[model samples]
Structure formats: structure tokens, C-alpha cells
Target: MKPAVDAIVHAFETLDPEHIDTLEALYAPNARFKDPFNDVRGWPAIAAIFRHMDVSLVQSRFVITERIVDGRQCFLTWEFHFSFKRFSVGQPQCILGGSHLVLDEGGRITLHRDYWDAAEELYEKLPLVGSLMRWLKRRANS
Candidate 1:
């Protein structure tokens, strides 16, 4: 439980639209953040992405299942639990993923990259695309 990793876990665990202001202390001023759907630099851009998430999802939270740290770099495996505003209401969804983070000497994140499968975790759960995506997966596997 390094200081940087602790900060990240705490920040994500308690994150929400209102609490997003707390990110400034966790990430560097010019930090870069990237995921399957976004690639952005600087805290403002990063915060914007999170704000979009707050608006789009009905509810969302992250559970860090495992963490490995070495020097200033760390890898975390997590489960993102969420419900889409436009889709399921009471039903919850989960995406299993990992993140790679690089921190500065001050323990503020300098780079954050997330890894996850869009097809399996997202598209395959959709109403129309789900069928096609499942078919494609079956074809690929068979």
C-alpha cells in the first residue's frame, strides 16, 4: 500500500461528480489519462472525462481487486460497477479491467492508462449490438 496507490484507491472509492474536485491532489497538473474511449492530457481534460461519466451513468464505482507496485509504477486490477442512465435502471453491470499508473516523486499520478474490452464488457451487453457481437465472437472462437 504505497502512498500513491492508496491515494488512487481512496479517490476512486469516494469519487462522484461533487467530489471530483479532490483529483487535483492525486494527479499532477499535466497528467495524461487514457482509456478505451478517451485520451487526454492535463487535469481539466481528465476531469471533463470523469464529469461526462457522472452525467452518462446512473451510478458507478470501482473496486480494486489487486494491486502491484514497483518504484513509481503500479498496476491495478479492478471491477467497475455501473448502471447506464439510458439502459438498465435497477440492474447493475460490471466490467473487469486493469489500469497502469505512473506517479511522480510526490506520489501524484503523471500517467494513467486503463485497459478493458469494449466488445465483451460493453457492446455485447447492448440490445442490438449484443447479438451481432456475440455472433462475431462465436465465429471467431469456432
Candidate 2:
């Protein structure tokens, strides 16, 4: 079971979009998924999110730094690299994040929650709009 999680993590880190096909075997049919921008229900929705990621980010990769599992739950810390359509041609930027996953009786993920600082990792990576966003955040917080 642990090895299955490792394989999934590896697939994610490697940014292999083809892995989504195996998700039906790894996640429950009604799995719940949550991230900074989306709160989705069911495996199909989760699969769509992965598909969107593959299409939007060129050469996207995930690198799992840490993983801990207790019973049916696992926590993973990871770093991701990818090139956006507008950023630096083909150069990838790194984004650090983590995920908490709860497995079902069959050792398939039933719930998955991703955590990341979007402002620092994504918003700051934007071009001209990034500076303005930073300024507005600073001013608004002050």
C-alpha cells in the first residue's frame, strides 16, 4: 500500500499526465479534492484538474520531499517546477507545497487536500502584474 502511494507521488513529481488514467485504481470513485483554487468532488473532477494542469503548464514536474503515513491518512511535502505560457520561454519555476490524503478501505485516496502559498509562489511569478499585486497586498495589509 505504501508503495502505491510512492508510485503516485513519483508520477506526480515527474508530471506525467498519463498517470491520470491510473487514478481510477488509486482513488475512490467519489473522492474529494481541494486546492487553493478549487474544491472538487469525485474522481472525474479531480482528474480534470490534473488534465488542466498538464495543459496549462509546460514541462511541469513534482518532487516529493517528505511523506508520512499513519493508518489511512498520509501527508506529503513537495516542490513543483513548471513553465507557464507567459514566463521565461521554457524555463520552469519552483513552487513548494504539501498534501494531506485520506485513504479508503481499499487503500485508495478518498479525500485529498493540497496546501500552498499561492501569493508567494504563483502571484509573485507574474510579470508586470506581479509588482502591482505585491504593492496592493502590502498597502492593504498595512
Candidate 3:
């Protein structure tokens, strides 16, 4: 399973539009994927999400910081780095998150669920919405 997970990590770290198809080999055909923004089944649907990411952002990559494997389940902590193609921040941004993956007997991922704070990691980084989101967060905290 380490090899499989390693392959997945390598693929994500070096992912690009041209090599997107290679990821299919790492997941089951009907594998399910869920994140803060999306929940979908099947390899094609999962691939679409990556495709959208490539189209919407630049210099995006995932760095897996830690991994815990127990039986057929694995939990990975990662940092997603990217720069918005639409907004020139002049510097990169990063989102801290984790993923819980369940693998089948063949080591193909059966379920891939990502956990992250959308409001903090994504929404609060936006240009116009950043201030509003921060204000709302402060209000909520108060």
C-alpha cells in the first residue's frame, strides 16, 4: 500500500493537464471522492475536479507532509500550494488539509475524502470576499 500511496503522492505533486489520465490507474473505476467543495463518484468525475483545478489555478501542487496507514485505510496531511490565475497576488498561497483514503484489496483507492476549512483556507483568501468573510467570522466569534 505504501507504493500505491507513494504513486498517488507523486502524481499529485507533479500533476499536469497532460498527465491527468495517468491518475485513473491509481483509483478504482467507481471510486468515490469528496472534499469541501465536491462529492462525486467514479474516476471520470474525480478527474474532472483536477481538470478544473488546473484550468482555474496556476503552479498548484500538493505536498504530503505526513501519512498514517492502518490496514486498508490511510490518512494524509498535506499542503496545497497554488496561485490564482485570475488574481495576481505576486506570491503563492497554501491550504492545509488532510485526506482519508480507503483502499480495496488491490490497493486501489475506493474512497477519497478530503477535510479542510473552506471559509478559512479558501474563501477568506479571495479579493472582494476576503474582507466580508473575515468580518463574518469575527462576528460569529463574538
Highest lDDT among the candidates is held by which one? 3
Residues 77-107 of candidate 1: C-alpha lDDT, one tens digit per residue: 9999898887666579999999999999999
Clashes of each: 0, 1, 0
> How do these models rank on lDDT, best leading?
3, 1, 2
TM value for model 3: 0.94
Q: Write the per-residue lDDT of candidate 2 for residues 3-96, one digit (tens) a residue.
A: 7688668667655777777766778888899999999998888889989987788788788999998887899999888898666658679899
Better of 1 and 3 by lDDT: 3
Candidate 3 clash pair list = none
Quote each prediction's TM-score: 0.94, 0.88, 0.94
Q: How accurate locally is residue 109 in candidate 3, as Cα lDDT from 0 to 100?
A: 92
Quote model 1's TM-score.
0.94
Question: Distance (Å) between predicted and true CA of 67, model 2?
Answer: 0.7
Give the Cα error of residue 52 in candidate 2, in Å.
0.7
Provide the global lDDT of candidate 2 against the true structure. 0.84
Cα lDDT tens digits for candidate 3, 30-101: 999999889999998999999999888988889999999888889999999999988755569999999999
